[model samples]
Target: MSATIKYDDVETGQQIPAADYPVRRVNLVMYAGASGDFNPIHWNERFAKTVGLPDVIAHGMYTMAQGGRFVTDWAGDPGAVVDYSVRFSSMVVVPDDDEGATITVSGVIDQKLEDKRVLVMLTARSGDSRVLSRARAVVQLA
Candidate 1:
């Protein structure tokens, strides 16, 4: 485990550098295998289009997990997280061909709570669409 991040050191408006999470077709396939969400919308383009989707799409939770990973990785500890939430604003369209999709996530310290906790605001974007909206995380710092 990495060293714990201190809450007192963070300032409001402090920006966490954006992270690019590339999601290729292989990633979707791996996520499907790990998450048990083998919905064709996540792997099979034909099935996705049959369901009226533009192409195979990533699972909402999968994208959310990436957002969480970004924060935790930055904070240096997963246990530091107290709360996290996001609204599924748009779909992450994953095509069957290569070049796939990439979701970029960024964060900022928004609010400081009592007892060494901080509220964070997050944004997740894929292509031109925002996949997660009103994303927030409350973390407990050491």
Candidate 2:
């Protein structure tokens, strides 16, 4: 937690600083092992192509978690997030390279709800595609 965001200072439509999260093949393998999502499409390029996908892709939940990190980081505490959701809108293609893929996440306060909570709308992108849609998080602020 860097600095606490007070509810009194927060405004609807206020933008949170955007962040970029990088995903590599090793990350996919690790996430697969940890999450038990061992689907080949996440790490096997041949299998991904056989399934009609463009190279290996990052897990949807992995992408969502990155978005979650963005919100929690902004709130300055993971527990500040009361609710979070996102719809998978596009695939995040992970290439077999050092750079891998980058998911850029940005958010804004959409609405201030009751009891010191605000709805945060997030935008996530990989390359030219929007990877997540209807992404939102309800955060509790001090």
Q: Which candidate is the best by lDDT?
A: 2
Error of 1 at 61 (Å): 0.5
Each prediction's TM-score versus the true structure: 0.93, 0.97
RMSD of each: 1.5, 0.7
Q: Candidate 1 at 73: error in angstroms?
A: 0.8
Instruction: Tell me the lDDT of model 2 at 70.
Output: 93
lDDT of model 1 at residue 114?
94
Which residue pairs show collisions in model 2? none
Per-residue lDDT of candidate 1, residues 80-129 (tens digit) = 78889999999999876667899999999998889999999999999999
Flag clash pairs in model 1: none
Tens-place lDDT per residue, model 2, 41-130, is: 999999999999989999999999999999988888889999999999999999999899999999999999999999999999999999
What TM-score would you give candidate 1 relative to the actual structure? 0.93
Best by TM-score: 2
User: In candidate 1, where is summed lDDT lowest over 10 consecutive residues?
Assistant: 1-10
Model 2: residues with Cα > 4 Å off, grouped in runs: none
